[model samples]
Target chain A: MTDDSIGAFRDELIDSGLVIDAGVEGLYGRTLAYEEIVSGIIALTTRTGAGDGAMAVHFPPLIPRWLLERTDYLKSFPDLTGSVHTFGGDDKRHARLLALVDGGHDWVEVLEPAEVVLRPAACHPVYPLCTGGPLPTQGRRFEVQGWCFRHEPSADPARMLCFRMHEFVYVGDPDGAGAHSELWLKRGAEMFESMGLDVDVVVANDPFFGRAGKFLAANQLDDALKLEFVSPVSSTETRTAIGSVNRHQDHFGLTFGIESADGEVAHSACFAVGVDRTALALLKRHGLDPGRWPAEVRARLWP
Target chain B: MEEEIRQILEEHGRLPVPMADLDNNADLYEAGMTSHASVNVMLALEDGFDFEFPESMLRKSTFESVSAIEAALTSLVGTPVE
Candidate 1:
């Protein structure tokens, strides 16, 4: 999309009271009306038999650095990771920090690293919790909702640095994991199509880091392990990945020592829906006014 | 050309098997070549062969095997080959 269109869309969102201008690129506050639509969309999409027996888990936005280290997140996304830092200054240092802030001289240098880093994805925390044992005979499923942070800052609202993801994760044997992801791929497509959005399910991969990451992305796509449900959010020509169904074959299982009931390293998969991006997609497609949306679309989201 | 491709594979493909042992049409991924490694190979190929891969040729199929890579290069360079 052109910069002009993106700027216009941002203006429309702010003018319509759907998005509050936080003055920072890639960061915006959601108004109550926008939040009501987001909550309604989440409720509608998550109303499913897929998560029937899934265990619900809630995670804080910040995860332990040790846990993140175990997941190879630091290795793959060193550039995008955010660590929590706090001021650990004595009186003298505190006085210096105050002076720096007062003079607007970038006082952030005084803050020391906390033990936790902002969580980058919704599924990483689930892997550690399910460690130390084999899953049940039928496998295990979990439903998680949490804020995720990335260092990416862009003018596009859909590419927010901080956003909430509602994810459903499954751990089991390879076959079960594959089946679960495939099912979600289909369900995710149907869910968005029913919502009146033209969605494309495409083979995709992560933005792995540096020179080696290029091959990683290609291999992931070659393996057909990652599928994205993309829709036109910011621009019609450029689609955004609003949801993704990923099949991680024994990667997490081996790292966390999780096993399947059959005595092999378990395979894992997760389907995550970007809640805010979906809301933004709705606004982009159906216009800023919800009243002008298709009758069925309005009913499904607002009713 | 084959030797050049093999050299690129050896340097950047990170294949678990030796370059000589890999079949011309064998799936590179099956031999433990990762996506990250494939990207390195792609860049190496572009540099060694003096050709740029278009967006259409950037998918997994383009780097699936030695034969596939050879084909992509031949197509990009627009030359006949075995």
Candidate 2:
């Protein structure tokens, strides 16, 4: 969609009292009505994946900065990653910072990089747990949910600085990983359809950064490592990716030394749902009010 | 040029198998070159050849094989010096 139309849609959302203008382009506060939809969508996801025997794991939004450095994330997406910073100086340094602030000059130099970084994806923190060991014969599965951060700020309402993600992760041999990704690819599509949203599952890639990333992105596409479930939310012409399934072929396993029962490096895959985007998509499809949604959809969600 | 390419791959490709066992057309990535290794290989090639790869040449096909790397380098820096 055109930039102007996207802004108009954001304005419409604000006028409807569904979202509050936070003054930031990509950051918004949700009303009770908007939050209710979000909660309902998350509950639906939990129910849909309940039969998978995946152990539920919850994580705070922060992880160690060293763990992020150990992976290839910095090389692939330096532009989108966010590291935490804090003012950890002596009293003299604080005085200097205040003086800089008083003079209306940049005061960022006073802050130092903290021990943690904002979690980039829901499944990221789980990788370290699987490290330095071999998985069981049946492999491992986990259901994780957390708020993820990316530095991308845009006019599009779907692209937010921070959003909640619900992910189902599997770490095992190549065949198991492949099967896990395949199973979720179908289930994700079906779940969206049952919610009354017409979605398409298509091959996709991460937005790798810079000149080197072009080739890396092509590599990912050629290997069919990623798939996205997209539907028109803010605009029909440009669809938003509401969910994705990614196959990391021994990438994390090698980085973290995670092995299979037979001692081979484990492959990993995850299917993630963007909770905020899904709520937005549902609102766009059914209406602004969730109370008036189709009986079937409401039953599936609220029940 | 082929030998030089093999040398760079040996140092940076991170392939499990020996480079001597592979043919020119063998897919480097399939042979165990990770995405992180590919970035290193790209940077080393630019340094070794003293030429920067244009954005168009930055794709998997351009570095999928020893021959593909040769072709890409030749396009960027003309015929192989060797």
Candidate 3:
């Protein structure tokens, strides 16, 4: 989409009460209707054939620093990671902080890094929780949801800095993990398409850091490790990847000491849906009035 | 031709090792060229050679090595490597 269209779309979202401007770029508060639509869609999507006995876990927005370190998130996306920090200051330091703020200077210097960092993704915590043991012969599946934070602030309403993701993670042998990812790639497409959205399932890669990361991206694409379900949320020409199915072949399992029944490092995969993005895509595609959407679509999400 | 490409790699490739030390056929990405840096190299090549890389030529293999880059440039200019 053109820059003008993207800007207009952002304005439309605010004007229509779909999103309440958080006064910060890439941060938004949803309206009650918006939240209902997103939550409803998430519930409906996750319920499809979801009776696989997956463990449901809800995580806080912050993850421990040591756990994040083990995931190599900082190595790949140091620019996007957000760490928690707080003021651990004496009364004298507090006076200085107040003086700085009163003088219109930066006062946040008093804040020190805390034990936790804002969770970058929903699946990072799942790996650590499942570590130190071999998996069952059928493998383990987990359903997790959380608010994830990244530093990529943008005017595009689809790319929020803090958003929710509903993910299903599988840990097991290579074949199971790979097949799980592949299955979800198809299932995710069907889910969106059924919602009357034009969906494209494509091979994709992560935004790895630096020059060495180019090879990593190429290797990722060359191996088809990531599949994204994209739809035209902001622009018709450039579809946004609203969700992804990723197969991390033995990467997480080895790092966290998770193993399969064969005593070998397990493979892992996750299917995550960008709840906010999908909701925005619905609004963009079907117009601001959800009541006027296709009966089937409304029934699917709101039913 | 190799020297010219090496100049660009050294200036813009952002490899860990010096461009001079890299083998002509060694993969630049393996030597530390990232996707972000490769875009810089691509732009530099375009400016130096006065040609645009076609979309079809924008694959990983096209910039895998110094030789591959030289080959892509050769094809773009429709002439033998200098």
Per-residue C-alpha lDDT of model 3 across residues A1-303, encoded as one tens digit per residue: 678988899999999988899989999988888988888777876786388778989999999999988886776688899999899999999999999999999888988999999999998888877766778998999999879998999888887999999998999998999788878887888888889999988888788776445555766787687889989998777998888998887768756888898897788899999988899899989999888999999988978
Candidate 3 residue spans exceeding 4 A from truth: B1-82
Task: Kindly give the stretch of ten consecutive residues in candidate 2 chain A with the minimal lDDT sum.
Answer: A1-10
What are the per-model C-alpha RMSD values against the true structure? Answer: 5.7, 1.8, 7.5
For model 1, the stretches where C-alpha displacement exceeds 4 angstroms are A49-51, B1-82
| TM-score for chain A in each prediction | 0.96, 0.97, 0.97
> Per-prediction fnat values?
0.45, 0.68, 0.05
Q: What share of the true interface contacts does candidate 2 keep?
A: 0.68
Give per-residue lDDT, candidate 1, residue A156. Answer: 81
What are the per-residue Cα lDDT tens digits for candidate 1 across A1-303?
A: 698888788888999998887878988888988988788777876685344588888899989989888776765678899999999889999999999999989999999999999999988888887777778888888888889999888888788989989988999898889888878888888888878998998887678786445546656766888889999998888998999998887767766779899887788999999988899898888888777889998888767
DockQ, every prediction: 0.25, 0.67, 0.07
lDDT of 2 by residue, A183-208 (tens): 99988999999999989987887788
Q: In terms of lDDT, which candidate is strongest?
A: 2
* Candidate 3, number of clashes: 3
